[model samples]
Target chain A: MRITIDEDKCCGAGQCVLAAPEVFDQRDEDGVVVLLDAEPPAEQHAAVTEAAQICPAAAIALA
Target chain B: MTEAPAAPAPALTTRRAPGCPFDPPPVTQELREQAPVTRVSLWNGSTAWLVTRHEEQVALLRDPRISADSRHSGYPTVSASFEATRAHNRTFITMDEPEHNAQRRRFTGDFTIKRMQALRPRIERIITDLLDAMEQAGPPADLVTDFALPLPSLVICELLGVPYEDHDFFQRCSAVMIDTRSAPEAALAASQELLDYLEKLVEFKAEQPGDDLLSRLAEQYLLTGESTVDECAKQARLLLIAGHETTANMIALGTCALLQHPDQLAAVRDGSPQRVAGAVEELLRYLTITHMGRRRVAVADIEVGGQLIRAGEAVICANDLANRDPEVFADPDRLDVDRAARAHLAFGSGPHQCLGQNLARIELQLAYPALLRRFPGLRLDRPLEELPFRTDMAVYGLHELPLSW
Candidate 1:
């Protein structure tokens, strides 16, 4: 899966990090989205997709 | 084309439907179907666009041009008192952009899902202790006072390092701030009093650091000059009030909803962790206690749902109605604990979506099963209709939920 995120759109609600921590993280300074792994392993694909779907700001997108 | 005589605009403050306490005010549901976003008159002599449909609510909330700053000219305040509170200190949620992000990020670590999971055992112990007290006191208790209010209050106190003994004081001030009935002067005074108290506490914490949030905030902000002492205090006050009031109401109201639906209550009682977690999301969606809507002002003209929200236009995202939008949730009115309800806007959406949600989730997850298991035969002490719901307050909840086992 190809993962994409717009940091400017992140509100730091932290749902992405919660859903797939190995692939997503928040900047400690301002809680904006930080991609930990742009192409995470297949095992993390479902969680990354779920995170993208539930992101309140629609900041995360995966293909 | 001649414009037919325009109908008089509806007042947004009208009471919720008589028999349907769980439903959004009937007018809002109707608006969702017809208008989706339409102007409504407020308690004050002002008009703001009330956005009702779930899709529109979500889209608009994520629009960065919409600002939540209460002090902005077109922002709709719940009442004169709510407007007055803005003159004092605006909490982080009411802020936008870089400032709000910076302030909110400061506390995100404390509420991350991972951090909250680590604190679950401690939260479970707190719930257990409260249940023990309720059990010892026996049946026929006002759950609002005996259990609901205190559980979150105590947890917030420990989290912020504020003494639990001072709950009565802060809670009273919080009520004044949120109570739509309070006079502007009274509300202003209550806010000032709480600010002064918090300022003092922040000062004390700075001098004598502890593991609590306030002390840590003090070391991080004050010591580094990232924020002023007053700023830290105001943030603490926001956390204390939001942390307890919303969750407390949820506990009482959720329990009441469960009792009304024995099958749903049984589902929660079964305690399969996944089932219970799903139940919490369903309960949050069904009982969106922040019924006044999240108010905002459009900073730039934006077309949403085929309507143009012009710059400087006030908007209220009616979440309660949005949660029940039939286009999103099937059989929306039914209380089904197993429903997939995580997408609901109970904690709101966008940058200002509830910051304490992770903490709130754990509290509710532990609260429901613990309360139910402790009092196996729990039921309402009086007829459900006779109980007074806090409709007059900015937040929707039971004023006092009486219970018996």
Candidate 2:
């Protein structure tokens, strides 16, 4: 699965990081989304999907 | 435009049913089931759209047309104190985006999940120390005062560089600030006192910057001209109050809820760290402490859940009700510790979603398990019915939880 995040739209709630820590992180400066893995392993897909679905800002997208 | 319904709108303020302190008011559940989007009369006799379903609340709260600016004439407030002191207590939470985003980002870095995770050891230490003190004092301790309240208050004080010794003064002030029934003058005085205290602290931080949030705000915003001293202080005051009161209540109320359900309480007490974390989410969903619905105003006409909310109409997204929406959680009312309840609207949704949620989550995750583990035979000293719940306050919680181990 491919993952993408719109940093501009991220409110830094860190839901994505909480859901899939391996695939996402927040910038240390402003807590904006910091994509750690563009293509995570199969085991992480479900959590990544949940992250995208529950993101308050709808900032994360998956393909 | 959709024609108005014939029935008289119910008042927004509804009491929880007797003997059902954990449940939302029966009226709220009925509305969520029958009419998810409908008008409700506010305290001031003005009407606002009350959105209760989870899906509709998520949709409407995320819509840019629904404004969070409390200054808007149509914005619904929970109390006279809230309305009268609205101007004095204005912070980023009450502002619309671009501006809101700008101000909120200033402190989000310090509250990120990773940053908060790094504070876990420190938080755990604080919890252990409090429990040690509570144990030393023996049984029949007021957990609200001795444990729950101080845990978060101390953590927030340390994080913001505020002296924990003055908790009595600030917590007293915070009580009036959150009390829905507080007089307008009392609320204003409380808010002014906190703002003034924080303003002085910001000036002190500017002169002697420390490794804390307030110091960073002082160095980056107050000194750099990015924000005025008053603006910095207001934000600080917001964090100080928001950081402590909500989490403190959650600690106290979550404990009460868990103790009532032995199965859930045991799950939290004996569960692994992972299980404890999941239980925290369920507790947050089950006893959503922010009982006062998130207030907003419609800046443009919008249709949600088959109802037309006209421009300038106020809106109250009853998140506490939405968290209990059956569509989102199976058997929504049950407090199952193992449930995947992370999607709950306890922290709200959209851009204005709580910035301190990560920190709050960490605090709770550490607090609940540590608390139960420390006191294996923990039980409520008073009957649940006799407990004084903070229904009079905007944030729902027990005013005092007398616990005996």
What is each candidate's DockQ, to 2 decimals? 0.51, 0.83
Writing each residue's lDDT as its tens digit, candidate 1 over B219-252 gives 9898888888878888998999999999999999
Query: How well is each residue in A9-32 modelled by candidate 2, as lDDT tens digits?
Result: 789999998898888888998999
TM-score of each: 0.95, 0.98
Instruction: Give the runs in model 1 whose Cα sits over 4 Å from its true position.
Output: A17-37, A40-46, B1-5
Q: After TM-score superposition, what is the CA distance of residue B298 in candidate 2 from its true location, in Å?
A: 0.9
Please, what are the lDDT tens digits per residue for candidate 2 over residues B65-92?
A: 9899999998898889999999998898
Q: How many clashing residue pairs appear in each of the predictions shown?
A: 0, 0
Recovered share of real interface contacts in candidate 2? 0.72
DockQ-based class of model 2: high
* Model 2: residue B386 alpha-carbon error in angstroms: 0.3
